[model samples]
Target: MSSESSQLHIFFLPMLAHGHMLPMLDMANLVASRGVMATIVTTPLNVPLVSRTTSTPTSTKINILTIKFPAAEVGLPEECEILDSDNSKDTMPLFIKAVGMLQEQLEQLLSAYNPDCLVADTFFTWATDSAAKFNIPRLVFHSTGFFCLCASTCVGLYEPHRKVSSDSEPFVIPSLPGEIKLTRMLLPDLPKTDAEAAYIAKIVKTVNETEERSYGVVVKSFYELEKDYADYYRKVFGRKAWHIGPLSLCNRNSIEEKLQRGKASSIAENYCLEWLDSKKPASVVYVCFGSLTKFSDSQLREIAWGLEVSGQQFIWVVKKHENNAGEKEEWLPDGFEKRIEGRGLIIRGWAPQVLILDHEAVGGFVTHCGWNSTLEGVSAGVSLVTWPVAYEQIYTEKLVTDVLQIGVSVGVKKCDGLLGGSIKREAIEKAVNMIMVAGEAEEMRSRAKTFAKMAKEAVKEGGSSYSDLSALIQELSVRRLHH
Candidate 1:
């Protein structure tokens, strides 16, 4: 950012989900670090979450602003604002509609604050139109990488997915940048209900309408990671798009400190970090399936047995069930924890993921390939056993395993259908061993480390991502000057 110009007061609007919110907030802080005044627009529940990160006693230039979450009006339960709420699966249509209902309030805020730029979540597609009306640039902040988004958008346009005969059969979409193959089973279906279908239709309509008008589509990926897809995305987007990401790289120190202090970690930090400390260097496999993944009891048993059978030191973050009265490992195999007591620790809630990934002992990640975790895993330089469970993550799994060669797939086609339908312990054992201790492990680890270096360099001065952000700031500064 050029100091000769006035400060860039940018307004950031993130999706209410933690995955979406966390990255956009991180982008906000990144810009704020570069002398931009960031105003993050979020709801009440997310406010506390944001404060926990932003309140880390520094002269952060970010400000938090709130709008009422339409819980009562939308027939949602009280205190439910995030998109990943327990009832979100049921109430998703209402939730999307309710978020759209905030458009007027958002427009009003835009009119009042008059930000130079509006960096908005993909869910809030209406923000682009609002930015157009306000004569400000609305950068579409995609929380994922270029490869997955490009592939999905191309698939949506061509509907090549329909050409595939069966879910199990492999098919190729020519529009994707690399030699990527996908099975129909790997892709997820949209809303099943007619009412939900209508709501999703509106979201699609609005997003398509606004994407043509958005200033740029922002991906949280670096150029070297996805050069071909980055070029393809620019050609498809037909705008001055940027790839200033692996956003986790922007706050290396703060995240390291948080993981070190175990302050905001989901488990008992003292126990968790101490356990990691006890492990050999680059030895433990940290397993988490992000926030949205839910495993069935059968699946849990397979996973527990798989980890035990793999004979590797591991830390697994298990999702807590709504009702847990007696046994601590009720959702897991009956004697699961006791059997792997010394080798693995299962934290049945949110773990300080960023901390765990950054730990020196963490050599392998059993991830669902959620975009945030992917970027974080890359930044941390850990080989990944890609276990995609939902969404367009299958494409991301391809991005890592096939394209980047930094990950190996665990053959988790879908989290649904027969309750994960028994993820054979052998498949899990093979993938874990591949990344953790097999012959291919060195190649994967080398690539992971290489990508990690790229991620670190991308955020530093004079790097590709650094130049892109500078270009964005300069482009916006000119816009502000003209205004």
Candidate 2:
């Protein structure tokens, strides 16, 4: 075949949120590096963020395409292009509505370009029909682990939680590999308010419809990371899927790339690196919930005291709301920063998480168990203190604390909403100690290192993820010829 005809062209559509967008872009670049023609489609405002994170001098350049977001039409502010989970409780429906409005623009692009494959975020349920119209294969991109994917799928199918009498009552997920159990309160469907309930219903319908129609799923995971679930997702469910990840591994080559990842760092990378440099290897804990989570004032103070009481050096990235960036937080314990001055650093907005986690001085992570953070901590080989707060995060906590055994839980018992349910200083402190200072800490660290090494190996030439990606490209290439 001619080189022109043989080159596989793939379009990646990520949700407007950073957690979803960043990793899909990472996968786009990884595919582009393997000689596929990769294009990332998003709205105008998000182009700069995407370009900055993926601005690599690679052999194959990834094309960034834009479509207008109907912010004004959806009653969102003119500047509202991306979804911020912290402030999005009331605006989320509007945001999703605005995103769905891009269907016409996406259809236009699909008709004009007719890319060989569409690797779209799972949030874009409509993309399945769009791709079907063009007879192009659409792969659902999930920025989550196979464990959560399988669990969520099984829960949705079996409605195991329906059997439980109370929200706190536990039930086993049926037809799975092992005895995995969770309380009804921890399930994703437990919506607090009518608005949230409606939102959850919409999301569930969107996911179910899209998954049934799409060609297959393209998950951001590596086979070795969650082998049983990966196998279970395909063998038990009888669907096509590919696991080409620890997608974070693509950023391992450059420090500049790591720093510029996602949004600009709130603090200077050099400043944070210098602080970590002074600390001994595996001596510090890096605490960050993913970008979307918001903590109540009470919870923030509890975290502060917990970190102080744990007596471990830490760098915490506190999520700052867009409107209140300059406001003084009344939540921090009085003189908390002063007391932990040398031993702790609190970044009020975006922190260079990848850069910090990759540091030798960093050992344990205090994570909310967002898949991206979970995978990053794994890639960095850092043990974790899991405190899951939102959708599927609690399920991922099970993967980390139970399956992987590289994490300690802070005993979060429910899928709390965006403003997470508070855990006392004692629970946080105890969990931190279990992962960073207790006798079992060494064992967790050892396991983290083992997975970290596997993560790196999975992305290398001939590794599990590398081979999966190659197979995907090959399959798409062959299919393109017929089309």
Candidate 3:
């Protein structure tokens, strides 16, 4: 390829969560691997997190632009610091709004570097307007799965009907061109009040309008996984949609290297991986929820008991701060840790999740079904025990348990109005036991292994994800030349 042909420049703007940033970074790395110059625009607070994950050297071709958030004092204390506590939720709205204010800085950076196109996160809808103002072609990158995006769209479309009433029935969302059948139960949390609903409506409208004006949509999913929905997006929206994912493919080789140089304390403890090494093939379950989701004390205790009852070798990541700090060891049931000491490992903070999942001993995952976690689990060929906590997670749980049939759902509530409540020790024990020791466990293991193989194949040359990525680059390259 000539210098002109190979010289592709793209900017990546990601939301400020670990789940969102990690995949975006992986995509940016993929672009760079293809000889494209990629610039990742992130908040000052997230720069360290990205740096820790990528460990991009000064000599590396890719550029990382860490822009300061405006009205720094308005909220979001992390705006000033490099490593803020991961549990911060109050800053979400403010951080989202701040993306709009970074337009001037982004434009200045763009003019200096002169890139070919902008590839931004879905949350950065404002980037579309910025790109248009500067005559730069833009692409919206949905970091999550296609199903989750569709569920969010459903919430937007059905906003008017969401009312809290005693006799209210579940609202059925009309079929979107490329979307799967979804109910209100599977959707993300929508704005409840009329005022909040109007705000969300405005945001969704802006997303649709901006998407129409952009070059295309790039999703972190593959054609085989959601072919029907992918087709629906292209047909109904009249906008090009490409699936180029399981982005973690590129990280397989460098995960260890990245961890060695990563600044996060949690990354240093290789105990989880070491524990997995001791278990038999497909005998251990790995349980972790993404950074933001929280459970009540009762729920946490129930899960502990469940694991105890299941009598399975498991690795669980529990946040120290989320639990009662004072009663840390005392919180568990009598001799719980002792009974399962050698069999189970309880990681207090963030574990080296990808490394743990890829370990040979890990056969199943007890996950909150966050998109990134789901993709990681799938890529690792680990079956899931779905326990969705919030937001689009419910949709993710449905995808894993219902649509994909790759995993089983736990704590699922039926129409009995009994509120299935939290997973008790016995229920957890039973679920884990079935997945680990029963015939169903083997079936799920086989299915998970197959999916993992498919994920591997998808990233190889000529595979669906590989082809989609090639097509995305070609489309962007063509748009660059024509414009």
Q: Using Cα atoms with residue i matched to residue i, what is each candidate's TM-score against the true structure?
A: 0.93, 0.96, 0.88
Tens digit of lDDT per residue, candidate 1, span 376-426?
A: 999999999988776777888999998999989888765452123357888
Q: List the lowest-lDDT window of 10 residues for candidate 3.
A: 412-421
Ranking by lDDT: 2, 1, 3
**Model 2 — which ten-residue stretch has the worst lDDT?**
320-329
Q: List the residue pairs that clash in candidate 3.
A: 178-232, 306-425, 310-429
lDDT of candidates 1 onward, in order: 0.80, 0.87, 0.71
Residue by residue across 387-419, what tens digits does model 3's lDDT show? 776666777776777677778878644211111
Candidate 3's displacement at residue 57, Å, is 9.9
- Global local distance difference test of model 2: 0.87
Q: Which of 1 and 3 is ahead in lDDT?
A: 1
Compute the lDDT for candidate 3: 0.71
How many clashing residue pairs, candidate 3? 3
Q: Which stretches of candidate 1 lie over 4 Å from their true place?
A: 1-5, 190-202, 254-263, 322-328, 414-422
Pairs in clash, predicted candidate 2: none
Q: Which stretches in model 3 have alpha-carbon errors above 4 Å? A: 1-6, 56-60, 78-86, 158-173, 176-186, 254-270, 322-331, 412-422
